[model samples]
Target: MSSIRSPFGQDVEKQGIKLPKKWNDTNSKIPTDRTMAVGGGVAVGGGGVAVSGDSSEFPRKRRQRYVEKDGKCNVHHGNVRETYRYLTDIFTTLVDLKWRFNLLVFTLVYTTTWIFFGLIWWLIAYIRGDLEHTDDGEWTPCVANLNGFVSAFLFSIETETTIGYGYRVITEKCPEGIVLLLVQAILGSIVNAFMVGCMFVKISQPKKRAETLMFSQNAVISMRDNKLCLMFRVGDLRSSHIVEASIRAKLIRSKQTKEGEFIPLNQTDINVGFDTGDDRLFLVSPLIICHEFNESSPFWDISQEQLAREQFEIVVILEGMVEATGMTCQARSSYLDSEVLWGERFTPVLSLEEGFYEVDYDTFHQTYPTPTPTCSAHELAELAKKGEEIPLPPLTPPPIQNPNQNLDGERGRGEWDEEGEVESVSNGDVKKMDVQH
Candidate 1:
C-alpha cells in the first residue's frame, strides 16, 4: 500500500496501510524546534505546519511574505525589458539619414539664398545711384535697370513653387536672370516628380491593394436557348466612391500533339455596367449574357474542368474623376474548380433589397428550353406529326460471296493484289513527301 502526505502535512494511507520505512529519515531534516507564538503564548506544534496561532500576527506576517514573493512584479519587469529592446532595434535599423539630402530642401535653400543676395544687390545699386546724384547734383550715375534684379528674385520664388506666375519677365539680355530661371525650373520639376512617384509607391504598397475589392465574388454558366451564358457579379465593399468599371474575360486552352503543345483559344470582353445609375456610390455590376457558347463558338470545345484548371482571370479596371484628378483602381478574381458550373446556366434574379443581386438557376433552366419564333407554328406542328409517324427504313441482306473467288468465280488469288509495292533500292530514288500536308 502507498501513502501520500496531505496538503495540510498530515500522513494518510490507503487499505493495507504500510508505513514507509524511510519516512522518518526523509523528514528528519525538517525544522521542528521553531514554533510560531500566538497571543499569550498560544503556539503551533513542533512541526512547521501552522496550527491555532494568534490570528492577527500570523495573518499579517503571511501576507507580507506573499507580497514579497509575488511573481507579477517579475513578469512586468520582463515585458518592459522586451519592449525597450524592440524599440531600440527598430530605431537603429530603420533610421534613414539620406532623407536629409532631399532635393526639395536644397532647392528651397538655393532659391532663398540667391533671392536674398539679389535684393541686397538691388538695394546697394539704388543707394549708390542716390549718393552719386546728390554729389553731382544730377540723377544719372549709370544705374542700368535694377528692375532686372527684382524680376530675377520674383522668378526664383515662382520656379521654386512651380507656380510660373508669369507676372515678371526675364530677358536673354540679362544673363543672370536667364541662368537663375533655368536652374530653378529644372530643379523644381525633378523634385516634384520624385515626391509624386514616392507617394504613388507608398499607396500601392499596402496589402489592401492586392485584395479583391468585392465580396461574394463568383461566376456561373447559364443556359440561353441552345447556347450557354456566362455571368458574374462584381461589387464594391468601400461604398463611398462611385466606381466606373470594365471587365474582360479570356478563355484559355492547351493542346498536346505529336508536333508540339500550344494554347489556342478565344477571349471575349463581356458587358460592363452598374445595375443602378452611375451617380450611385454603392454598386453591384451585373455582367450577364455577354457571350453565348454554341456549337460554332470557341467555348463549346472548352470543358468547364479545363477552364477551371487554367488561370482564368477577370480583371476589372475602374476609372473615375476624384478630387478633379483622374484616378484608376484594379481588382481581379480568379476561377477555382469549385466555382465552375458544369452543364448549368445562370439567370439574374432580382432581390427586394437594394444593392443585392442573385442568380436564379431554377427559373433559368425551366424557361431556357422554350421554343422561340425561329420556328413557325405551322412548321413545328408539321415536324412533330412527321416525327411521330416516321417508320424505320428496311434493311438489305448482304450478297453471298467467297473470299477466295475472283469476279470470274475462279479459285486461288495471285500472290500480289492491285500493284506490287514499289521498293526504293537507293536513298536517292526515295522521294520526300511534305509532312505538313
Candidate 2:
C-alpha cells in the first residue's frame, strides 16, 4: 500500500514543487521555538515569559514606587489648595519634619521672638529721650544700660531666658517697661512649650525602632504541608521582643475592572492565616511567614512560570508594640516579581542548643532549591480531583475462624491421637508430631 502525504510546504518541497515566491520569502526566517510577544516580554514555550534586560531591544521603564524598601511612603502631595492646613497643625508638622528642618525651625522661632522684643525695648528708650541723655546721672532710662540696639538686645535675652546678670535692669520709673517685661515673660514661656515639645516628640519617635526589625531580602515559594505557599522570613536584631506582633501583606498591581476601567496601583489583601490567628506571631526568634495559595489568594492561579512574568509587588507590614517603650511600631518591606524565587525555600536559621534555641542571623535571608510543582494551585486541585475519581481495587477479606476452634468445630476441647502423638490440622491435611520423653 502506498502512503499518501498532505500538501504541506515540506511535502511540496520533497515533491520538487516549490511554493510561490512571496510565501517562501515571508516564511524563510521563521523561528523554530514557540514564542509569543506579549507587551514587551517574550513568552516561552514552557509558559514562562522573560522581559528583555537589553536596553536596545526594550528600554526599562521605572515603576511607580508606592512604598520604598525602607518602609517610607514614596508619595508626594502637590498643588494642594489648603496650604494653611500645615500651619493649622503646625506642632505636628514641625514634629514630622526631618531632624535638620526641625532644628532649623527651633532656632528661628526663638531668634525671631528675641529680636522683635529687643526692637520694642530700643524704641521705648528712644521715645523717652534716654538714648540722648546717656551721660546724665539724673536721667533714669527704662532700661539701665539704654545706649543702643545692642544693649536693648542684650536686655531682651536676659529677660526671656531669666538670666538676670544684674548689670542691665528694668527701671520702675517706666511703668510701660514693667508691663513690657511681663508680656515678654509670658510669650517666652509659650515659645518654649511649642519648640521644646516638638523636639521631644521627634527625638522619641518609634520610627527608629523599626530599623532593628528586618525582613528577608527576597521572598520564596515552595510546598508546605502539601500546599504551595509564598513565604518570607522576619526577625528582630535587638534582644527586646515586640509585643502582640502581627504580620500582613498586600498585593499591589494595576488592574482593569470588568467595566473596562483601568485602576492603577490597586491593593489586594494577602492573608497570612489571619482567620486561624496564625498572623499573630510570638516572634521570639526568626519566623517564616507563609501565605498559602488558596481560592481567595490572588496567586491561586499563578504558576511558577507565570510568576516571573508578572509585574507586581508584595508589600509586607509588621506591627507591634515595643517592649521597652510600649509604643506601637510598624515595619514594612516589599518584594518585586524579580525578587521572588520560585521552587525555593528559606534555609533554617534556628537551631536547638543546650538550654535555649539559637538563631543564626547570618543565614537569615538564605534560601535553597526545593522540589515543587510548576503548575498553578487551581490546576493542581483539578488534578487531585481527577485522581480521586479513578477507581481503586477492592480489598480481600480474611477467613473468620477462631484460633481456639478444633477440627470438629468444638470449643475448649483438646484433641489427642491413640499413637501417643499430637495432631494438628492444616488447610485440609493433618500433621503428626512425635512425643518428647
Candidate 3:
C-alpha cells in the first residue's frame, strides 16, 4: 500500500482510497482540466472515510462549480412556474436579456403596438362610412384619403412617429376619432419612453467596464516580509483610474469536519490586509496584492509539497467606482491551486522613465525563481518558537606574526651589538650587559 502524508502530521495508507488526479506527485504531468471525480475515500487522521456506494453504483462524483472564473454564479432555477415574478419587474428583466433577445423584443413591442392601433384606425373608417366616400370630395371623412387597412397601418406609423405627412390629416367630421387620436398619442409616448429606457440602460451597462480591469493569469506563493504570502497582480488598461478600489479573496474548497459532516464547495474568506487597510488600493499601475499566511489564514497548513496535493480555488474580487462615469464596477478572477507557483516571485515590471513612471504589461505575469522555505507557515512558526538557529559559515583564524618583526612589520632595531648585548628599539637608550663567560 502506498502512503500519503496526511495534513494532520501523520502518514496514512492509500488502501481502498481513490485520490483526485491532481493530488498526485507535483512533478507529474497533470491534466489541464480542473474537474475531477473522487469515488472512494480520503484517509484522514488514520481513518478512512468511506463512501456508501460501489464503483458501478456511484461511478463518479461530479464537482459542481459554485462560481465561474469570470465571477458569474453557476446556479440555475428549474421547475419554477412563477412567470409573473419576471413580469412584476419587467424593466429589469428586459435589461438583463442578451443583446439579440433585447433587440428582438424591442422591435416586436413597437410593431405589435403599432398594429393594434392601426386595426382600430381601420375599423373607425369602416364604421363611419369614410372608406366608401374617399372619391366624394364633399364628404369630409374622419381621416382624409383613408380607405383600407394598409393606409390605416401607414397612418398609424405616421401618427405615432409624429411624421404628420399631411396627406392623411384627421378631420372634425368624426368626434369619436378625435378621442381615439388623443388616446393613441398618449399611449405611444408611454411605450416610447419605456422601451427606449430599457435599451439605453442595457447599452450603458457597467459590466463591460470590468473588462479593462485586468487580473494576472496566475497567482504566486513566495516569501514576503519574512512570511509566506499568496500574491496576484491587477491593473487598469484605461488612463482614467478606478476610485477607492479595494480587493478581497475567497478560498473555495470541500471540507470534512471532525464530526464527519461533509461540506461541499465551502468558501472561506482570505484576508488581504484588511486589518492594516492595505486592501484599499491606489491602482495607478499594476500592483501585486498579497495575502499573508498567518495563523488565521486558510493556507497556513499548505506547504510547497502539500500544495501539490491540494485542490482549492482562490477567487479574487476587485470593486471600485469608475472615475469617468461615477458608477461602481466590479472585476473578478480565480486561480486554481494548480496555477499557483511556489518558490517564485513576480518580476519587476515598473520602471522610471522620463517625466513619469512606466508600467510594462508584457512582463506583468512573469515570475522568477527565488529561495523560499518549503515548510508550511505552521511548521515555520513552530520552529521559531523553539528558537532554532540557522547554521552559519565557519569563522577564520588570524594570520601569524613573527616575533622578530615590530608592529609596523619592520625588523627590530635591538640587535646584538659588537661590545655587548645592546637592545634598543627605536630611539631608546641601549643598556649594555657585560658578557662574562
Candidate 4:
C-alpha cells in the first residue's frame, strides 16, 4: 500500500486499501508508470490503478471578466422611478418663469423697442405735416417721404411680427428724414428696456400653473335633493406658490328644430372653487336641476340610444394663470352613450398624479332619466270620444251556451248577461273585476 499527504498535510495511507496487487510490484518497471495517480492515493507501480477525490468535490477556479458600463442589465432595474424623478425635476423647474428670465428679457426688449419707434414716428408725422398723393388724388401726410415716420412705424411693425412687408420707403436726403432715422435708432436702444419691464410685471402677476388635483375620476352617488352634482380635481404644479382657481363647465348639445336645422343648447354655468392646498385642489359643482330632462325641454327628446351613437362634448374652462396675466386651460372630451348611463350626468376625469384627469360616465347617466310626455287636453278629448264609440268593449258574456248554437248567437246572449252584470256592480268594482278577470 502507498500513502500521500494532503494539502493540509494530513497523511492518507493506501497500503492494503484494496488497490490492485500487481500495481504494488517493485520491479515491474514500465514507461506507462509515469501516468500513475498521485496524492488521491490508489496507485500501481507499473500499469497503476488510478484514484481521485470525489468528483462532486472537485475544486474550481474562479475567473474574472469585463462588464460594459453602458446601462444594460441582466435584471429589472428601477427605471420608472428614475424616469419619474427626471420628470418631476423638469416640471418643478418649468413651473416658474424665473429660470427663463434671459429669454423673457430679450422678448420684452424686442417688443418695447418697436412700440416706442412707432409712437415716435407717429408723433413726427403729426408735427411735420408732410403730404403725399393718394390714389384718389387727395393730399395725405408724406410721413415716409419727408420725416420717414411712416417708414419707422412700418419698420417697427415689421420687426414686431418679423414679416417685413417692405412697402414704406425712407430716404436720408432731408433733415426731417435724418431726424426720423435718429429717433428710430434711439427707439431701438430703449426697446429692450421696455420689454424687460413688461416681462417683470408679467412674472410678478399672480398666476397659477396647472396641477394634478384628484386621484381618480369617480362617480358621485349622493347629491343635494333635486340638484345635479359634479366633481373635479386641480392642483398647482409649483410647490411654494398658491393658485387661486375657478372652474366652469358647459353642457352643449346640437339638435334640429322646426325653424331650422341642428342648433346648440347650452346649459347654465356650473362653477367650482379651490382654496390653498399642497399643489392640489378639489372642486364640486351642483348641476341646475331645473334644466334636467322634462317633456318641455330638449333633453326629453334625447334618448340613450341617441346619446350612445352621438357624442356630447363637455367643455371645462379653467380660469387662472401662473402670474395673474389671466391664463386659461381647457379640457374637452367626446362621451359615448355607453359612458353616460343611469340618468344623464357625468363626472370630470381626475389625475392619478398631478396634471392628469379622466371622466366618470357611469355616475352621470345613472341619475338622469329620459322624460315622459303627458297628453294635451285636445288629445284627451279625442281619446274620450273614441272610448265612447268603443262601447266598453261590449261586456264579455257568461260561458253558458247551447251546444248546437252558432258562435254569433251565443255571443249575442252572452253580451246581454255581461251588460246586466256590469249594471249591477259599482263602476269601481266593475273596473277592478274587469282587470282581475
Candidate 5:
C-alpha cells in the first residue's frame, strides 16, 4: 500500500487513491512530445514532427482536441478523471449532487431506515406477549390504541425522538426492549448529523460565489498612457456586493530545465491595481485590472508576434467576503493566448438610465478597435526616451566665375585691310590696320 503523511506525522495508507502529481520535481523525466509542443522551445526535434515551424496543417483533418474543458492546453496532456475507486469519493459525490436530487435521496433513505428499525421493535413486542387487553375485553397495544404491528412502530418513533407518551413505557420485564431503544436513539443522532452536515456543506460551497462574479469574454493587451498593459474586466452580477474585494493575477508558462526536466507549468504572480500598491478595489461596478509590462514583468520582452505564438495562460483570482452571507468566497478564470485581443478596448458596460444606474450585460463581452503602438512595450519606451529631434548639415556658398579671360580673338593692334577684307594671321588674327570710317 502507498502511504501519505498526515498532519499528525503518521503514515496513512493510500491504496486505490490517486493524487495529483507534483509538477516541479527536479529529477522527473519529461516526455519528448511535451517539450516541443509549442513556443518553438526545444532544441532537438520532438516526435519528428518539425518542432521549429508551423505545427498545424491547412487541410481538414480528423476531429481533435486542442484545449481542455478546464482551459488547459491539451496538446501534451489531459486531466485525470476518477480520483478514487469507491468509498473515498462518496463524500465528494454527495456534495456535488443537486439540491433537489439530494433532498429526494435523503427522504427515501431516511424513510427506509425508520421503517427498518420500527419492524425490529414490533417483532420484539409481539414475541414478548406485551400486547395488553382493553377494559372492554378487546386487545389494545400500550404503544397505540390499535392492536397491530403499527402500535409498536409508533412507539419506536416516539422512543427514538425521546418523546415519551406515558403508555408505551418499556418495563424491566423486557430488558432487550430498553437496549433496542438506546441503540435506535444513538443511530438517529448519527444519521441526522451525517445528512445535515453534508447538506450544509453542499449549500454553502464557494462555487456559488462564481455565479455573481463575471469575467469578460476576452482579455486585451493595449496601450495605457503610452505604455503597454494587459487588461480584463470583472463585475458583480448581483446588486448585493462583495466586501473587501481583492484581485490577483498569475502568468503561467511551461518551462524546461537544463537537466531536461520539464515543469508542466511555472507560475509568476502579477501585481493587480498597482497604481495604488493595494490590490483592493470596489467591485460594485465593473473593474478593469491592469498589469503593466514593465522591466521586471514576465512579458516585458515579449513582442506582438511572439506573444501571439506563445502558449501561456493568465489566471485571475478574485477573493472577497459576501456582504449578505458574511462568508469568504473566491472566483477564478483563465485566459489563453488566443483569447487575448490585441489593439482593442473594452466597451463601456455601465450606464445611467433616467436617475438610476444600470449595467448592460449584453455589452460585457464587446470590444472596439483601438489605436495602439505597433511596437512592443519595451521598444516603445526606448523610442520615447530618444525624443523627436532632426539633425541637418550646415549650408555652403557656390564658386564665382571670372570674366577677364575672354575666348574671343582680337587683332594684336590693327589688321591691314588690303581689299576691305581681314587677312589671316598666325594667331588666327591678321595684322589689323586701323579702319577709319
Candidate 6:
C-alpha cells in the first residue's frame, strides 16, 4: 500500500530536499512528554481541560500548590484573633475601620492641634508688644479689630487651615511674629499629611472586589430529580455582570500523615450541576450549586445522621472579573458540617412579575423541608432491593356465613331483629320459618 501524505503542510520534503543550516544546528527538541499514553493508548495528561474541583472528588486532581510568599505578604496578628506574637496586620486594620470612627479621630486631632498652635501665637503676640490701632496711632495691638490675645489665637487658626485669613495677618514689622508664622506653617503641613494619609487609607479599600457577592446562609441536602444532592446558593446583588465567573467547591477536613503531622486536607472537588462542565454558572440571578451523590461524590457514603456528626467544611469560592473595574475578584464562604441541613431545600427567591424579574432577598436564607431520603444513596438502594424481595401479606375475604343462622326458631322471622328472628338463604334457595299468630 502507498503511504498517505497530508496536504496541509509539507508532509513530504520534496525528494532530496536538505534542511537549512540554522534549522539543523538549533537544539530543536520538542516537548514529547506533556502527554503520556498509558495502557492501550489512553491519554492521561497532555493538556486536557482540568476538571473543576469540588469537595467530593479525588484530592490528587484538586490539590493546590504554593507558588511564593514574602514576609510582608503574611500577617501574624488580627484585632479579632491573635495570629502571632508582635506582628500586626496593617491592611486588615485599615480595612476594618468604621467611617464614624475615622471621622471622630480626625476631628479630635484637628481641634487639639488648632488650639495648641493658637495658644503659642497668642503668647508670641504678648511678648512682641505691637498693635495696629485706629488713626489714633497707638500700640493698639497688631490685630486691628480684636483684643491682643484673641487676635493671636485667631491668626493661628487661619494660618494652619487656610495659610492666612486677612482678618488676622502677620507681617515682618514684628520680627518675632514673622518667625512664629513660618514655624506654624511648617507644623500645619506636617499635620495635614498625617491626617490626610489616615483618611485616604481608610477610603481606598477594595470594597468593590467583595461587594454584591455572598454565599447561602446554610448548605442543604435535597433530592434534585430523584438524585440525592448537596446544595448551596451563591448570588451577586449588583446588576453589573461578573465576567467569566468560575466557581469551585472543596471539602476540607483534618488529615494526619504517617509522620504524625496533621494538616487540613482538601479531600476532593464537588463538581456542581450536571457534570464536570457544571462549574461555571450564568450568575445573572441567584444560582443554586448542586453536587450529586454518585460514586464520585464525597457524600455518597454519608447519610443525614452521619453528616450531622462529621467534622468537615465545604469551602466555596467564586472568582471572576468585575465588569465595571475589569479587576479579578474572589468571594468565598464555608459551610461546616453543623451548618449543612439534610432533607431541606432553598425556597424560591426569583420570580417574574409584570414582565420584570424580581428577587425576594427576604427568602434568600430560608429553606423548607423536602422529600429526601435520610439514608445514604448506597444504603437507600439496598433498602429498595430488600423491599422488592419482601412480598406483601395476602388479604383474606370475609366469610359468607349468616349471623341469623345461629339464632333460635322461637323468634319468628317476621319479627324485627330487636326481638329475635332468623332468615337463612341456601344455595339457590331461600327459607323463612316465621308466623304471626
Q: Residue by residue across 1-437, what tens digits does model 2's lDDT show?
A: 12112111001011222223243454563232322223333333323455455424653223334566678665556447897999999888888898898889899989998899999999999999999999999888899976999999989999999999999998889999999999999999999888888898888889999999999877888778878899998999998999999999999876778997667678999999799999999988888899999989899999866775666779999999999988899999887666677766666767779999888887677664445688888887887878843222221112324433332232211234554443433223455545443
* Pairs in clash, predicted candidate 1: 221-345, 222-345, 222-346, 223-345
Q: Is candidate 3 or candidate 4 better by lDDT?
A: 3
Q: Give the residue spans of candidate 2 off by over 4 A.
A: 1-64, 388-437
TM-score of each: 0.32, 0.74, 0.74, 0.29, 0.64, 0.50
What is residue 125's positional error in candidate 2, in angstroms? 1.4
Instruction: Name the weakest run of 10 consecutive residues (lDDT summed) in model 4.
Output: 62-71
Show model 5 residue runs off by greater than 4 Å: 1-93, 97-105, 131-154, 161-173, 274-278, 352-356, 384-437
How would you encode candidate 3's per-residue C-alpha lDDT over 180-264 as one tens digit per residue? 8998899999999999999888887789899888887668887777888999989999999999999999998877799987776
Q: For residues 1-437, write the lDDT of model 1, one tens digit per residue.
A: 34333112222222232223333465563232332222221243333234354444433111000001101111112224355665466423222213454445545655665576456445544555533353553444323333456654554565566665555444344454456556656766775665555545444432343243442223455434433455454444443443444444444222334776433322344333233233223344322424445434445445433443232323233333222123454444433223344433232333435676554332221111111222222333455568853221221212324332222122111111122221111112332212111
Candidates' C-alpha lDDT: 0.37, 0.73, 0.73, 0.36, 0.61, 0.58
Model 4 root-mean-square deviation:
35.5
Per-prediction tally of clashes: 4, 0, 0, 38, 8, 10
Taking all chains together, the TM-score of candidate 4 against the true structure is 0.29
Residue lDDT tens for model 5, 1-437: 44322111223232232223545665674543343223222232332333334323232111111332233334433244655743587766777788898888778767766787778877775664445443344433333343456776777677666787776666555567668877988998888788888888888776676677888766887777767888898989888899988998888766777999767667788877656756796898887788888887888877666664465667888889988788888887776665677766676767778998778787676664444555577777677689842221221111223222111122021122333322222211224323223
RMSD of 1: 33.8
**Residues 246-266, model 4: lDDT tens digits:** 444455444446886445433
Worst 10 residues of 2 by lDDT: 5-14
**Candidate 2 residue pairs in backbone clash:** none
The RMSD (Cα, Å) of candidate 2 is 20.9
Error of 5 at 103 (Å): 4.1
**Candidate 2 whole-model C-alpha lDDT, 0 to 1:** 0.73
lDDT by residue (1-437, candidate 6, tens digit) is 12112111111111222223233433672233232112111223433424333423432211111110000111123234554532366444534668887688778878887788777776655565543333445554444444455665677788888855567565446676667667878988987887787787566543556657868766888777767889898888988888989888878665657997656443667877535667887789888888888878878899866764455667777888878767777777666555577766676778768989898777676664445667787776576668743222221212324433322222121112322332333223444434232
